[model samples]
Target: MPDTLEPVRIASKIMKINHAGEFGAINIYRAQIMVARLFSPQLVATLEDFLSHEQKHLEIFGRILQSRGIARCKSFWLCGIGGFCLGLITALMGRAGIMTCTAAVETVVTHHLLAQLASLEAENDSEAYQAVQSILSEVLEHQQHGIEQSKDSLLFKPVSAVVSCATSAVIWLGFQL
Candidate 1:
């Protein structure tokens, strides 16, 4: 590939990955909401709201990918499966687990989105830049909510570390495959 073409390729791939990640996010919230309805009814509304945002995000990326004639990342289904399982397991732990998972995943996601935005800017791809930029505020809000909800510093810190690391690993693998 020509050196100039490399950025486009990377940007395209990242967009696809971001789309797939949104799928994962949607599933996470879905699973959480499922459990929350029974155990944490107060949280159901919150989880549903986040899920709606993720749905919008997924649509944004999907539309962009379609316009560019790009397929979704191969990891899309894998992410959905992993997200559901992760959400189920965490929701079982109640608020702490749910918030920890959200905080950790969104932390990694926020960092990657910024990096991806920089790459898009370098490429001067306004469509991609705007797409990534649009979802950032909600993602940040979700992160902040998670951090606030998890009152137990002792549990939050350690569990969040583990979840964040795993989220990072998954992202790396997504870029690779």
Candidate 2:
């Protein structure tokens, strides 16, 4: 019989990819917040809080990547640039639009993290299982906060899917590049 280690390897790969993606998310939010401060100080402060949480998430995954000896994709630089560019564009779109973008990104990230957690559960990978559990909890907290904060806004349920799908597809392709 083939070793079950194969699934574990793939799981590790997913985890690393996820970690890199989280890093990109962090940078995107940071750029958005930076650009936001120019016109909307209060909103930028709010975004910064969630951005800090994402930074922590990135740290957790970075540790996991290091422990598993998983190297980040070389194309992650391109992904970062793409995320930064998206942030710049969103910022240019104005405060409401930026928050809408934030909500969209968080929603998709929450779903993706949940899926990764499910995969880890299926693999029964104890270490990765624990990591995913921790990370998902953190991500869910941010997701809930974003949803609540944006509930009455124009971005809550209206534009999240379209924006998220478009941005996520672009970012995913950026990683592949």
Candidate 3:
């Protein structure tokens, strides 16, 4: 790639990864909401609120990706299915399990966004850097929300580590994908 285009490529790649992640988040929340009826109304309300926030994040990232002309993942449907399966697995593990999973994923995403923000800052591309900063702020909010929601759960620690590791692995493979 040409030198000038390299940064744009990096930005676009980050955006693509973010877009996919946000989409997956939305799907996972959707699955949770679908299964919420089996649980309490209070739990359902919380999950619904989380889902709405994720939906907004998805919409924002989708617009950013589209405006940048980045093509969405060819396997997005498959990814959604995979996310649904993950949600189902968490659900089977119970409410605490599902909440832990959310916390874990959000923690990883927050760290990933931090790294992206650093890279964008280092690149000295103000526009892209600012965009990343904005994304990072939203990601931080999401992480905090997840933590607040899952604070009382015993599985939070283990779930956070496992999810952080899994998300990192997924992102590593994403570059090749």
Using all chains and alpha carbons, the TM-scores for the candidates as numbered come to 0.94, 0.80, 0.81
Q: Which candidate is the best by TM-score?
A: 1
lDDT against the true structure, each candidate: 0.88, 0.68, 0.68
TM-score of 2: 0.80
lDDT of 3: 0.68
List model 3 lDDT by residue over 1-177, tens digit each: 111223546776766677677777777777777776686345678777777776776676678778877787554564466667766667666777677778777777777777776666667756656655666665666577667867788877776677667666666555556
lDDT of 2 by residue, 1-177 (tens): 111223546566666666767677777787888888897787877778777877787787788888878787555665577668767777776665676667677677666656666666778777877776776666666567656666676654555676688656744553443
TM-score, cand. 1: 0.94
Better of 1 and 2 by TM-score: 1
Query: In candidate 1, which residue ranges exceed 4 Å CA deviation?
Result: 1-8, 151-153
In candidate 3, position 85 carries an lDDT of 70
Spell out the clash pairs found in candidate 3: none
Query: What local lDDT does model 1 show for residue 156?
Result: 90
